[model samples]
Target: MKDVKTRAETLRRTIGHRVVDGKDAAVVTVSQSYPTDADDLWDACTNPERIPRWFLPVSGELRVGGRYQLEGNAGGEILTCAPPKSFSATWEFGGGKSWIEVAVIPEPGGYARFELAHIAHPEGDHWETYGPGAVGIGWDQALLGLGLHIDTGAAVDPSEFEKWSLSPEGLGYVRESGNGWYDADVAAGTDPDAARARADRTIAFYSGT
Candidate 1:
């Protein structure tokens, strides 16, 4: 298993807000480097069967302008696709429309970097209540699973994840991830007390504590 403390310190997380086309949106960005070639990392992310191994089971046409859905998760339209490099898509879920983009960058020594940005326009009180950790934690967990999958070439079982999340180590990782995003929010100008409170709620939601 990957070291939790190492990941918490190594993986990069950023949060910011923006107004796009007259609509305000919250942006969450996460990035991590993996020990794999760019093509392999891209395939691990975009391949239909491989997705569920790390993230969630996904089904869709997958071509540009095609629609796709993650089982009991987000569904969206594929906006753009560039081989072994990047992809952009619309993220629609919980009665809201958002956007997501993933970029794969090649590095020296056969390593690859994955960067993900999730943007959503929070409707009334949502941002104050949950903050970025609402989705950021989920993405962090997905990234962790992806790292494990790449290192071991074994799919993560959902049931195993459930039990692990309740363990002390898992709970600590979840809490730290939430707090990391909260710090990012504060750096982006959110009130410190408010951001910390929201982080507490996010941690509870994910850790089920």
Candidate 2:
């Protein structure tokens, strides 16, 4: 992978709480700047053909109110779209549903900012057990793949990622990312010790250890 350790540190993670339709929800945000333009970055994100290059094989209608399925992953309806800027979609998987928004903003320094926000109302003690790192770490890896694709025009092999994620370097990257989210969790008023414990469990879960 392209500087996996650097990629883990490059991301900014934030955990925020909100009231979503009478229920408490967590909003996990991850953003990173890449050497690309907003239009290209937006295309890489929303285009079905390009998505599989870095993320997953997606099959869906590319319009508002259309349904999209990300192979073996989440599937949901496109809620809103503004093209080359931002979009909102439902994230339905694991028998539960949440909301996700993607924003591509052009920075002044010739880079585009890719920001993803995943908002969910966790069931039971799921948040206490896994914390934001549960999803934050996954997004870290996905964005890293996007960065690699943007830099080298290469497709990131999913199987290779699965194998690399268990390797030493991968574990290190995962640990760093989980801890970063742990810090964000603490900033969001979670107990430090409890958040650290959750980060550990999340790392172990993702690294399959």
Using Cα atoms with residue i matched to residue i, what is each candidate's TM-score against the true structure? Answer: 0.95, 0.97
Judging by lDDT against the true structure, name the best candidate. 2
lDDT of 1 by residue, 21-101 (tens): 698788899999999999999999999989999889999799998999999999999999999999999999978889999
The lDDT values for all models are 0.90, 0.91
Query: What total of clashing residue pairs does each candidate reach?
Result: 0, 0
Model 2 per-residue lDDT tens digits across residues 12-91: 88988799889989999999999988988999998887899999999979689999999999999999999889999999
Span of ten consecutive residues with least summed lDDT in model 1: 1-10
Model 2 lDDT-worst window of ten: 1-10
Q: Which stretches of candidate 1 lie over 4 Å from their true place?
A: none
Say what the RMSD of model 2 is.
Answer: 0.9
